[model samples]
Target chain A: MNKKNNLLQCPNPQTECKECPIRKMALFRDVPEDDLGWMQEFRNSQYLLPAREILFRQGETAHTLYTLFDGWLIIFKILDNGKRQILRFLLPGDFFGFQVNSIGPTGGYLHSSLALMDSTLCAFPTTQLRLMMEKQPQLAIRLAEMEMHDMNLCQHHLIGTGRKNAQERIAFLLLELFHRVRLQKQNDYDESSNSIIFPLTQEDIGDAVGLTSAHVNRTLREMEKKGWTQCQGKYLTIRNEEALSKTGQFDPRIIISKPLI
Target chain B: MNKKNNLLQCPNPQTECKECPIRKMALFRDVPEDDLGWMQEFRNSQYLLPAREILFRQGETAHTLYTLFDGWLIIFKILDNGKRQILRFLLPGDFFGFQVNSIGPTGGYLHSSLALMDSTLCAFPTTQLRLMMEKQPQLAIRLAEMEMHDMNLCQHHLIGTGRKNAQERIAFLLLELFHRVRLQKQNDYDESSNSIIFPLTQEDIGDAVGLTSAHVNRTLREMEKKGWTQCQGKYLTIRNEEALSKTGQFDPRIIISKPLI
Candidate 1:
């Protein structure tokens, strides 16, 4: 009945592990080349998801782990009353779907991941990854470090979600996302651009900050009117980052850049 | 000189690997005996923290990770405006101090930990643990799974903090703490009691639920009046878990009982 393609299974041939884009990020920067090759071999394929497509469902079996190769996704949970909370947003090089496979059938997927835009995810079979981890222990250590980093980030976000006001929540989310994107962009070590493509919708922002879409619109407009940021179409630029950071109490350095292992 | 014995270092020789109280918990249930022995040898000592003492501070360099040997502790972040959000309430055998060593000196600890009651913590040097993990790869894998599980729990808590109403928040927190305590008590494999010794102060409860201490007091009194729960001294018993869970949408099975790795 539906003519448009909602999801596409992309044919992905194994590429040179050394040239993988996410290798330069903190998640994989320190991985040895041999282990990286194992990862490349372990990867099943890449899948393309259209905007608004459900990458994984809350009550379904999730046996695959995904790496964000491109575009944006939001990991969210819907409550009994139909209220939603965005747990974390995925950017290029970020890893997700780890939780689903980590916690199996009892809960199925802890949270459902939805693509915010057309996204490409490199899928890896959990069983193969586990086997590979057994052969190469450092890979497991690296993955643990990555998990610790993710845990820390989520705890930090809880501060904004649990205690901060609406204005502060929006500010914190913006500054945090900007920093994460900037960090990912540093794969090429580029530092010239201070702008990023804002892929989030107002509704998405509302779910993230625990506010209504109307509240998000009002707060964002206020931020723009104050000259703290500029939002033109898809691009969001921090015009007065100092003031913005002060308002949000956001310091990116607080997010650990160094790997734990 | 103020000699109040702020930190009392308790002498702890390595215990038998098979006798660890927390070994039965999901975090370390699967770890081999040799790896457990390595953990025992790596522990520096256990420290006794008095009630209301700070275990760690924000912005302080952290070189150790802690295991809750006894009593209770709360991991929290204080906002710029002085509001506090309780990140997690650590039970006996829960891991705390994992962040300090993870992030190191770049930004130090992003949050502060406080003793909710007089507590004993088994401290392990992060560097030594890292060394041991390198030799025993499976240990690293297990630790990663532990971190993943913690991250998942925090993400779930965000739903109550960010979206749930005051009543729902209180209900969710109570049900969750009860479940965690029940699970921790399962170390003995005993299915005897439904009551738990709740060591949290009203302010601590408020911080966890994003409400004022006064509001928390009122909510507790209301719940008591409703016959859904009973609070006597420090012991809390779920009188009507079915009703309470329905109100909070609390589901314990959703928390992964099995380790990932």
Candidate 2:
């Protein structure tokens, strides 16, 4: 795969559904083992999106949905005035690309998704969604559960931006991403260390938390000075988790919902 | 039904599924006529919530999910600092009460819901959702579609609070509510009139748009002074729809998604 380009179509044979490491946490988590072959047939292909590259853009006709196999992505909307609002931060095991203005064949994506790091995604044709749901009712239930989870996070962010101050918003966002990364149980997270691989820039943080990059920078400095957190060399260390949680009013329990399926 | 208390148990017979006035726009919109009787059996009861009454509170154990047969409601979360963030404005035919931290039987609501006006709601047991979805897969598909629609609205609000100015946020919210009210094709909305029965107070607008009541009031006055809108005697009239849409970057098409079922 070319690291310089936006996206590269991986030439390797598609990973079997039964062998997928992330399947246990994905959209098909509830499908029985016997049904793995059927699901594998439905998946289109796997693609690699290079860091800082857009996987898809807003208003583009959407033909596929993707399950993040690896890496981080941001789903965002750019306003008419040229400002961007980050709607969601996607981590591995996250299923996305379903937000659209219409469900019709010609419907366009409502937001653009860009990879924060080189990401691998398992793709599925949008046209098969309904049929697949009908065949496996559990999938629809899982989708509803997933959407509810995403909605909960969206509301949490709304609370942060709408009611919380800059310090609170930044703290809440950092804690949220931290908890989410840990939840994925991936290799990047080390239990022995107090830090995770932080890929978001100050501007990205500002877009997600509704602040200017300068404001985010100042708040980060304040947080660092207080010995609550450290964001340097692309790593975020939670030196004082209790203090940060208190300041942010964040409870990690909110991210621990069980899969209904 | 008594108007003095928050909730009133109506003695009136439950409305039959087939006879429900708002069924076409509700959760059971796509249920076949022959299936209405089965759905009616699953419905528990109907209750009345008087204007300015609490329907449910955050952290309360949730046993029932509701479909608003009539009237307005607001879903909100209150911060520890006593601030409130209005998440979604519910309209007639809107189904809600499923926002929970967990889907387990002991799950509690993550937000509070309040009736903005005299409202009637049809109730269903939460425990029956999965069973019913299994029996009627179309219902599950319909639910996912509804959730996607709601997620879109939530994302829209995120953008308003994160990127748009006070004027733009207010304009966008007003236009959004206006368009949604009109879409219902109900008695409250008159084809000849440019106004709907606006039930929200300035504080409500403030909470939803991430502004202070004073700021919302000032912005509304400015918009009114410019001959763009009028808010008086519980009515909101859009005198300049085009200009308001331009300012808000609002598009009616976003709210006109086809029901996937």
Per-model TM-score of chain B: 0.88, 0.93
lDDT for A198 (candidate 2): 93
Question: Model 2 misses residue A95 by how many Å?
Answer: 1.1
Question: For residues A123-237, what per-residue lDDT tens digits would candidate 1 score against the true structure?
Answer: 7775676787777787777788777767766776788888888888888888988888887776564587778889888888899979999998888899999998876578888
Assess each prediction's global lDDT (C-alpha) against the native.
Answer: 0.75, 0.84
lDDT of 2 at A249: 94
Which window of 10 residues has the lowest lDDT sum in candidate 1 chain B?
A: B98-107
lDDT per residue for candidate 2 within B1-261, as digits (tens), equals 222336677677767889888887788988898998988888888889989888877777777888998899999888899999999998878888775422323477778888899999888888787788888988888887888778778888989999999999999999999999988875645687888889999999999999999999999999999999998778999999999999999988878656442
Classify candidate 1 by CAPRI docking class.
Answer: medium
Checking candidate 2 for backbone clashes, the offending pairs are none
Cα lDDT tens digits for candidate 2, A5-85: 366887787678898888877888889999989888888888899899988777677778889999999998889999999
- Model 1 regions lying over 4 Å from their true place: A1-5, A11-14, A26-30, A100-107, A187-190, B1-5, B11-18, B26-31, B34-39, B100-107, B187-192
